[model samples]
Structures are given as C-alpha cells and as structure tokens.
Target: MNLPQSPNNAPDADDDLEPVGPRPRPKGIYALPNAITLSALFASFYAIVMAMNGRFETACIAIFAAAVLDSLDGRVARMTNTQSAFGEQMDSLADMVSFGAAPALIVYQWALKDMGKLGWIPAFVYIAGAALRLARFNVNIGVVDKRYFQGLPSPAAAALVMGLIWVVDDAGIKGVGRVDWAAWSAFAVTLFAGLSMVTNAPFYSFKVFGGRRSVPFIVLVAIALGIAVVSLDPPRVLFALFCAYGLSGYVIYGIKKSRGKPVSVIATSTDEPDEEGLHR
Candidate 1:
C-alpha cells in the first residue's frame, strides 16, 4: 500500500542528498582598532566645533591630537593583527576632515576671509590637494615604499597651516583688522602649502619607531628640552619649524632634480611588506 517513488528519485534518499554549504554570517568587528579610529574621528569633530567657537588655538591642538591618534590606530592594528580594509578607509576619511578640511576652514575663517573671493581659493586648493594625496595613497598603498612618503603628508601640511595660525595668534601680529593685503597674503600662503602637499618632493616619513643607533644622552636631553620649549610657545616655534620642514623638501628636491637626480629614488622600509602597506 506504499506510494511509488518518482522515476528520478533514488531509492536511498539520504545518499542522493547534496552537501550543505557553510551558512553565511555577518562579519565580526574588531573593537580595539575601531575604538582608536572612533577616537580619532571624535578628535576631528571636536576640532571643527572648537574652530567654529573661535577657539582657534584649541581647534588646532585638537587637530594635532587627532593626528597623533590617527597615526597610532594603524600601528596598533598592525601590531595587534587587527588590520582591515574598513579601518584603513575610515582612517583616510578621518584624516581628510581633521587634516584637510579643518585646517583649510580654520585658515579661511581666521584670516583668508578678509581676502574676499581670493580667500576661498586657497581653502579649495588645499582641500583638493588633500583629496588627491589621500586617493593616491589608497591606490598605491601596497606599491609604494613605506620609508618615504610620495609627497608631503596631509597631516604635516595641516600642521604647517595650524602652526602658522598659532604663531600669528601668539605673536599678536595685528593691524590687519580690516585689511585686504594681509588677507591676500594669508590666502597666498595657503595656496602654496596646498600645492606643496601634492608635489613630488620627498618628505621624511617618521615611520620608524625606536630604531636609531648611537645618540648621546645629552643630545636626547637637548631634544626633550627643545620640545618642552616649543610646547611653551608652540605657535612661534613649532609653526616656523614645520613650515621650514615643509618648504625644505621642495627646495632640496628641486635642487636634486635639477642636478639630474631621480626623484623616485626613496629609502626602503625595513618592515616586511603587507598587501595593504605600500608607498611609492
């Protein structure tokens, strides 16, 4: 009285069953690296808020703090074996806001605004250069040498701008209260920095951590003392120092290139290469 099986059906039904594939599940998130990235993002957001509130010095400091946090997140990820595509992209986005847009806006509002249409030009230029630098970094991540950045890093460029602002604010270099000339000069400086960020000049990528051999204790103490001094008057000291660092790369590179030296020659990274870590 049993029902007949279809012609296509196997007598041993279990034998005819297909293997069950692994079920798809949601991706697991890494907490530590993501936390660092979130902190960086918050730092950048706070910088913008401070800048808007006319707390220009605080905003600049916030941006620099964000840069420190931003630098740490990637290293932390690599050290903890938690590196991910999501973290890399997030870091770049945070950098664009903190280093790219924030500095440009701060400069524009603080000084460039007096230059009328010209004031906005440098802001746009810096932003565009930052975008290009980030895009190039992402694309060449695994292809470029890590020991040297292809161009001036965006954070350094932002630092230069903020440092200049801090110097001016601290020094109380006034008399431009309603002057177009001062505003235009600020705009011009911004434009130059923006262009420099994307230039082919080589900048020392302070990527190496604690690998230096043979430094006198006195030299170390002197460096620490210098940092302390700069901290006391960061606007004047740090700004001038970073500005010179930013410009020096271009001058050195130009001289080298004119003397028939190859611009692409750069120092190689000592660390083992990862698919995600590349510099050109």
Candidate 2:
C-alpha cells in the first residue's frame, strides 16, 4: 500500500501565505513586586483618609511606614530579578502619593491650616517638588553617580516634613501649645524643603553597600550607641537631625563654591575612563 505523501514533502495549498501577525502577549500579572506596590498605595490612601479624620499622628506614622515599604519593594524586585517597566512606573506613582501628597496634606491639616491660603500654598509647592524629584530620578537612574543624589531625595524630604510635625506634636504634649507663628514657620520650612528637592546641590545618599571602610568595629559601635540614645526621643532628635541635614546641602554647596572647589556635579556620562583607564 502506497502511503500518502509526507506532509513535509508536499507544498500546502496556502504555502505562499504569510504567517499570522505576531501573537498578542498573554494576559498575566507579576505577583511579588506588584503586591508590595499595592500595599504602599494602600498605605498612602490610608494616610490621606486618616489625616482627614484629624488622626494627624497616625497619618504621619502611616506615611513613614509607606516610605519604608516603598524602599523595600525596589530592592526586593532587584534581588528577585523581577524588575519591569510597569513596576517602575507604579512605584513612582505610589511614591508621589505616599511621600508627596500624603505628607503635605497631613502637615497642612495638622498645623498649617491656621495659615489659611498661605498654608495650602506650601503644601502644593511640596507636592510639585516631589513630582519633579521623582521624574528626574526615574530619568537619571543608572546615569548619575550612585553614591550621591543630585538633590534632596523625595523620601528624605517627606521625612523632614513628618519629623517636624512629630516634634511639634511632642512639644504640644509637653504643654508648649500651638502657636500661629510656629505653624506659619512650618509652612515656610516645608516650602523651602520642597524647592530644595530639585536643586543641583549634592546630598550624601548613603550608598555604602559595597564600599571600603577604614573605620574600626568599635567606632561603628559608638556611632550606633549615639544613634540609640537619640532615638529614645525620636520626635525631637530625628526632627532636629533631619532638619540640619535638609539645610546642609545648600550650606555645604555654597561654602564649597565660594572656596573655588565646587561640589561635583552628578556624572551624567558613563563611558568616561577612570584614572586607571577602566570605564567609569
């Protein structure tokens, strides 16, 4: 019996036909990073709702917790090699809500409300600055120096706002009582911090994950002890410390420029050679 001609040896009736158009991607979602991002978004939304209810202290804590969660999601993504364009964009959006809008609104409701229109203006300024900061950061990632940030980081900026409120609340607990002028001053402070987020001044970014260190173990222990002492009164200590750090960039930048040794601008090109001729 003659077997039918093999299909591979025979020309199909539609042999001249082009293959179908590229298939659409299957609809599925990544789990871990997306989950973390959603949690952060929830935290931001909770912060706004709590602030509206006049739960000012709880709102501040929620924002800080959200900030912590935001930091983790990226590192987790990188470690898991699950990075994606969708996740990156979602992260930035969550940050704007958590670190930008939430903190500003909380501060405004907690303290700056007394200043009326002027108070609201600073909150708006801060939110605008955070948006700009995040946009710039997303664009500059991997292009700029990883060791230092080009300007004040959005989380740090939010921290400054939260720290100030915490300090004020603590003082209120101590019977210092709220002052109208203090609220106005806080508005001014927040506005200045927001402006600084987009400035060119370099701030130490604490990117010490893989660097050599000469400090001895004892020195690190001492530093940890100092930090622990300060943390005992977190509201007072952290507020003052972050406020100083927030202002330090401008002060240090001005001093260096005046001395004719300008702070190094963030390196934008990655192909330049180092002293030993390896690519920077």
Tell me the TM-score of each prediction against the true structure: 0.78, 0.78
Displacement of residue 242 (Cα, Å) in model 1 is 0.7
Tell me the alpha-carbon RMSD of every candidate.
Answer: 7.4, 6.9
Name the candidate that leads on lDDT. Answer: 2
Error of 2 at 265 (Å): 3.1
The ten-residue window of minimal lDDT in model 1 covers: 271-280
- The TM-score measured for candidate 1 stands at 0.78
lDDT (Cα, tens digit) per residue for candidate 2, span 115-201: 668677888999999999989888678666676677798888988988877777666542211576667667877898799898878
Q: Report the C-alpha lDDT of model 1 over 67-96, residue by residue, as the tens digit.
A: 888888887887887877688778889889
Model 2 poorest ten-residue lDDT run:
271-280
- Report clash pairs, candidate 1: 141-278, 144-279, 144-280, 145-279
Clashes of each: 4, 0
